[model samples]
Target chain A: MGRIKTTNNQISRREIIIEKAATLFKEKGFKAASMREIADVVGVEAASLYNHIKSKNELLNIICFDVANRYTHKMEEVEASKLTTLAKVESLLRFHIDGMVNHFEEVYVSDREWKHLDNPYLSNMQNQRRTYRKRFAAIIEEGIKKKEVKKIDAATAVLIMLHAIGGIESWHRSTRKIIGKELEENMVTFLIDGLRKI
Target chain B: MGRIKTTNNQISRREIIIEKAATLFKEKGFKAASMREIADVVGVEAASLYNHIKSKNELLNIICFDVANRYTHKMEEVEASKLTTLAKVESLLRFHIDGMVNHFEEVYVSDREWKHLDNPYLSNMQNQRRTYRKRFAAIIEEGIKKKEVKKIDAATAVLIMLHAIGGIESWHRSTRKIIGKELEENMVTFLIDGLRKI
Candidate 1:
C-alpha cells in the first residue's frame, strides 16, 4: 500500500476519487468495474485506495447523489430565474445534453449506473430523481399557465426531454458526423422549439 | 421440432418460436437468455431447438430485421398516402409508440438487442436503421417545406421522436398510472403537436 498524498491539489482527494471511479463505472458499468482498477486509474495503490474512499458503493452513492443535487440546483436556478419558460427550458435541455456529452463520465454514471447503489441511497436516489422530474414537469405546467407554451401534457414533455437526450449516448461512439456544439445546438432547438405555439 | 404438428395453426410454429424468444430476450436480455431456455419456454425439446431455428444469433437477426422492415414499410405507406404531413408524422409516431408498448419484446430487442447480431447481419441492420431514421427525418423536411411543421432541423427532430418513445421501456415496469391507450394518445399528441404553427 503506497500512500503518499499530494497536498497542493485544490479539489478534495475524495472528489478526485469519485471522478475517476465515475469514468470507470461509465466504461465498465458499476458491477463490472473494480476498486483496484479505479485506484490504478486514479494513481493510487490498490490497497491504500480504501484510505481515500470507504468502498465502491460509497463512491457510487456520492456520484449519484452529487449529480442529482447538481441537476436539482441547476433546475432550481432556471426555474427561479425571470427568463421566459422557453429560455428556462432551453437552459435545462442544454444542461442535460451538456452532461450527456461533455461530462460524459460522471453524468452518464449518474443517469445509468445509479441502480447499483445500496440501501437508503437507492430509494433516496430514485426519490430525488422522481422529485426532480415532477418539478420539471411543473415548469411546463407553469408555462402553459402563462400561455407561452403549447398545452401539451407536462409529464409527457418531461419524459421526452429526459429520454430524448439519452440518444446522445450512442453519439459518443458514433462517427461524430455532427460535432458536439452543433448537436447540442440542434438538439436544444428541437426541444425548446417544440414547447411553444407559432 | 415437436414432430407432432397441428398443421393448421394460423401462425406458423416458427412465428411462435420467435414470439417466445422475444419474451425471454425482453426479460433476460438477448445475451443472458439462452437457446435451451428459449426451447424450454417454447415447449420444445432442447436438442430439437436447432431443428426449428438455426441459433440464437439467427433468432436475433430475424427479430431485428423484421421489426426494422415493419417500421420501414409503415413509413413508406404513410409517406405515400394522401394524408397531410402532420397526419403522416402522427401516424408514424403512433406506430412507434404502439410497437414500444404493445409489442414490447420485439420492438425493444429490435431497438436494443440488435448489436449482438454478427457480420453482414450487423452491417445490414445498421444500414436498415440508418435508412429508417433518415427517411423519418425526410418526413419532417417534407412538412417543413409545406410549412405544416416548424423548420427545426429534421435530423434533430428524428432523434427526438425515435428516442422519446424509448422512455416507455421503463413504463413496462412502472405502476400503470397511465393506461397504454391513454399513454399512446398523449404521447402522440406531445410529439405531433410540437410540429407546427397553431
Candidate 2:
C-alpha cells in the first residue's frame, strides 16, 4: 500500500512537470524553454526536477512521443473499425481537431518543436511520422479503389487534410467566434466532402 | 551614368544581403540567426553588414514585407481581373504554390519568423496579414453570392487553402517525386473542386 501511494505520487508529479513543460515549450519554443524554468513553473526546485526526469530532452521526448503515440494508437483503432472509408476519414479528422482542442499545447509542441529533438530520437520520430502519413495515404488509396473517394493523389489529399486541421492553431489564438463543434463540422465538410467522388 | 550605376550596385547588394539572410533565418530561425553569421554567408565583414541594413530585424522586415507585398499586389491584380470567381481562386492558388516553389526560403522565413518582429512592426505586420486574409475571404464571399462557390464559411475556406499550401514546406524537404506543376494541379483539383457549387 505504501509503495502504491509512492508510485501514484511519482506519476502525478511527473504529470505536473510535463504539463508545465508543454506550456513553456509552446510559448518560448523548445530551444528557448529551459528545464529550470519549467521546474519553476511546476513549483519544484531545479535539483528536484532531475529526480523525476533525466534531462530537458527527456521531457521533450516524453511530450512528443506521448502525442505521437496517441495519434498512432488512434489510427490503429481507426484501421480496425468497420467504418466506411469516408467515415474513417471523418473519424481521423475529428480525432485531429479534438486533439488540437483538448491538448492544444502538447499537440502544437509536437507539431512544431519536434525539430529540436536530437539524433536517434529525431530519426525515430520522423520514421513514426512518415509511417503514420503512409498509412493515412493508404486509406485514401483504399477509398479511391473502392470508388468512395475521388481519383486525386492520395498523398496530396492527406497533406491537405492534416495541414488544414493544423490551422486550428490560429483559431485557438483568434476570437474563436466559431466554437469547437462548429469548427470541426466545417472542417469535416470541407475536407471529407472534397475527397468524395462526384 | 555614374549615379545610375551606384543605385544599381546598392540595389543588387541589398538583394544579396536579403537573400543570404533569408536562407540563414529559414535554417536557424530569426532569433537564433546572427547578423554576423548572415554576413559570413555573404562573404562580408560583420561590421559591413550594417552599411546595407540597420539591424537583423530590418533584414527580416524586408524579407517578410517583400513577400507580403508580392502577395497583396498579386491579389489586387486578381481582384481587378475579368476572370470568374473560380478562375480568380485558381489564380490565387497558382500564385501561392508558385511563390512557394520559386521563393521557398523567403516565403518560409516570412511565415515562420514574422512573429519575432518587435512591436509597432509586429502589429503592423499582423494588420497587413489580417487585411490580406479578409480580402481573400471577401473573394470567396462574392463567389458564394454568385453561386460560383459552395456556401462554406469563407474564412474557413481561406484557412484551409493557405495552411494546406503551407504543407509544401515538407514536400520541399522530402523526395522530389511529385514535381511542382503536378503538385499544384492536384492541390487545385482537391481544394477548388470542393468549393464549387453543386
Candidate 3:
C-alpha cells in the first residue's frame, strides 16, 4: 500500500511540475525560463525537481508532444466520424477552442515553444504537425470534391481555420466579455459558414 | 556637402541595422537576441551599433511600432476611402498578406515580440492595437447595417481575419509551393466571400 501511494504521489507531483512549467514557459518563453524558477513555482526544491523531471528540455518536450498528441488523437477521431465535412471541421474547431480556453497556458506554450524543441523530438513534432495539417486539408479536399465545401484551396482553408481558432489566445487577453460558448459559436459561424458552398 | 553625405549615411546605416535586427529577432526571439549579434550580422562593431541605434529594446520598439504604424496608416486610408466595407476588408487583407510575405521578418517580430516593450511604449502599442481592431470591427458593423455583410459578431470576424493572416507565418515554414497571389486570392475568397450577405 505504501509503494502504491508513493507511485501515485510521484505521478501527481510530475503533473504539478508540468503545470507550473507550462505557465512559466508561456510567460517567459522556453529559452528564458529556468528549471529553478519552475521548481520554485511548483513549491519544490530545485534539486528535488530533478528527481521528478529530467531537465528543462524534457519539460518542454513533454508539454509540446502532449499537446501535439492531443491534437493528433482528436484529428484521428474526427477522421473516423461519420459527420459531414463541415460538421467535422466544426467539431475540430470546437476541440481547438476548448483546448485554447481550458488549457490556454499549455496550448500557447505548445504552439509557440515547439520551435525550441531539440532534435529527434523536434522532427517528430514537426512530422506530427505536418501529418495533422495534411489530414485536415484532406477533409477540406474531400468536402470540395463532394461539393459540400466551396471550391477553395484546401491547404489555405485549413490554415485559416486553425490559425483563426488560435486567435482565441488574443481574445483571452482582451475584455473577454463574450462568454466561451458565445465565442465558440460565433467563431464556428464565421469559419464553418465561410467554408460552406454558397 | 560632408554634412549632407553624413546624414544620408546615418539614415542608411540605421535602416541596415533594423533590417538585420529584424532577422535576428525573428530567428532567436527578442529577449534572446543581442544587439552585438545584430551588429555582427550587419558587419559593424558592437559599439558602432550604439552610434546608429540606441539599444536592443529600442530596436525591438522600432520594429514593432513600425509594423503597427503601417497597419494603422493603412486602416486610416481604408476608412477614408469610399470603398464598400467588403472591399475595404479585402484591401486590408492584401496589405497584410504583402507585409507578411515581403516584410516577413519585421511583421513576424511585431506580432510576437511586442510584449517585450517597456511600460509607456507597451501601453501605447496596445492602445494602437485596440484602436485598430475597433476600427476594423466598426467597418464590419457598418457592412451589417448596410446589408453589405452577414450579420455576424464584427469583433469575432475581425479577430478571424487578423489571426488568419498571421497564419501565413506557418506557411512560410512549410514547402511554400503556393505562390503569393494564389494564397492571397484564396484567403480573400474564404474570408471576404463569407462576409458577403447571402
Query: Which candidate number maximizes TM-score?
Result: 3
DockQ for candidate 1, C-alpha atoms: 0.30
Best by lDDT: 3
In candidate 2 the C-alpha lDDT for residue A56 amounts to 89
Q: Write the per-residue lDDT of candidate 3 for residues A1-198, one digit (tens) a residue.
A: 111122444468778788889999998888778877887777666878888888888999999988999998999899999999888988998999999999999999999888888898989998998899999999988988888888888888888888898888778988756988899988888886652224
Global lDDT scores for all candidate models = 0.79, 0.83, 0.85
Q: 2 or 3, which is superior by TM-score?
A: 3
Candidate number with greatest DockQ: 3
What is the C-alpha local distance difference test score of candidate 3?
A: 0.85
Better of 1 and 2 by DockQ: 2
* Arranged by lDDT, best first: 3, 2, 1
Query: Which residues of candidate 3, in runs, are more than 4 Å off?
Result: A1-11, A195-198, B1-11, B195-198
Pairs that clash in candidate 2 = none
List model 2 lDDT by residue over A1-198, tens digit each. Answer: 111122444467777788889999888878778777987777767778888888889888999999999999999999999998888888999999999988999999998888778888899999999999899989888988888887888887888889998888778877846888988888888876652225
Model 1 Cα lDDT, one tens digit per residue, B20-137: 8999887666766788898788777767767778887889988888888888789889878999777877888888898887788899888766767889999998888888888887
**Local accuracy of candidate 2 as per-residue lDDT tens digits, B91-152:** 99899999998899999999877887878888989998888889998998888888877777
Pairs clashing within candidate 1: none
Angstrom error of the Cα, residue B31, model 3: value is 2.1
